[model samples]
Target: MKTPVIHLDVDRLIQRIALFALAGLLTIGLSVLGFHHWQMSDPYVRAVLEIEGDVSHGRAIFQMNCAGCHGDSGDGLVGPSLHSISAHKTRASLIRQVIGGQTPPMPQFQPSPETMADLLEYLETL
Candidate 1:
């Protein structure tokens, strides 16, 4: 008895792999967008974002609360450097990070929305 040999189409296999890779990347991108949207939609985040911020007051707030860890100029000390942090993180993310205190060694700071707005204004300047 002779056994039948099955041949595989290498081109088709490559195409299929590429298609799956593209689909996976699309899924990940959509998920990230969705998560960001959700974060932005939070009531507290929205409220904080709505308030106008005062840079001078914001600087004072940072000096009082954040200067110790983040350094006077937002340079890294015990905490990571926040220079251009606004470029790296969205306003919503920054709000959550400050209030959530998910990162250890950083205590949770639940300031009023106006105060948070002030702090955010100060951070943007760095």
Candidate 2:
């Protein structure tokens, strides 16, 4: 008995290659969206600074969200005083700190980006 030799089907091989190429393209597209890198240049990205929450609303947010740590006058408590925070940190940097949190003592506040920006702007007025 002779062992059978398998022959490559050229048409099938071509279809397989095409399918793999399409799959690769689709995977890359989905990855871009999942990671949001596709919109990084959108300017609306966090880089645009959408601090759309109203200052007055932010004042309330501060009293409720921040006063516990920052106090009515932006004075320090368990957290450092923010009275002159604007003088100390850039608006963007301040916004990042609030959202990202800091060392072990500071837990991250899960405020919407809008609320965080509003909080930062209101802090500036302090």
Candidate 3:
């Protein structure tokens, strides 16, 4: 019986290895970029980091205007839970909700710009 000879393409193997390395690097780079962008673009994160209102005053406003429906902790009552309001809503969206008002249940509130800003800050604390 005769043994057959096997051939190996060393250059092709090296090229494949290099290609895989490059692809891995590219994937890592893109993932890092995406993660950084996600953190910066998060509405809640930005809301917390930026200072536009007085959280203490905002707490007063919340108790006065929102406690009836949202509960003391915003854990919800007649209204939906607002404990994580910033996570789900942007400051602009909140402002609109307060000013424009939603249909039924959620009443229309015309808070001054300062008050609205304070409210947003208080919400971020929640």
Question: In candidate 2, which residue ranges exceed 4 Å CA deviation?
Answer: 1-48
Question: What TM-score does candidate 2 get on C-alpha atoms?
Answer: 0.57
Q: Which ten residues in a row have the lowest lDDT in candidate 3?
A: 42-51
**What is each predicted model's overall lDDT from 0 to 1?**
0.94, 0.73, 0.79
User: Which candidate number maximizes lDDT?
Assistant: 1
* Better by lDDT, candidate 3 or 2: 3
Which prediction has more favorable TM-score, 1 or 3? 1
Return the TM-score for candidate 3, rounded to 2 decimals: 0.58
Residues 1-126 of candidate 2 have per-residue lDDT tens digits of 999998989999999999999999999999967655534443433642654557787898889877887678788788778878889876655765776678546667767667776676688888
lDDT of 3 by residue, 76-99 (tens): 898888887788876656666666
In angstroms, the error of model 3 at 53 is: 0.3
Which residue pairs come into collision in candidate 3?
A: none
- Rank the models by TM-score, top first: 1, 3, 2
Clashing pairs in 2: none
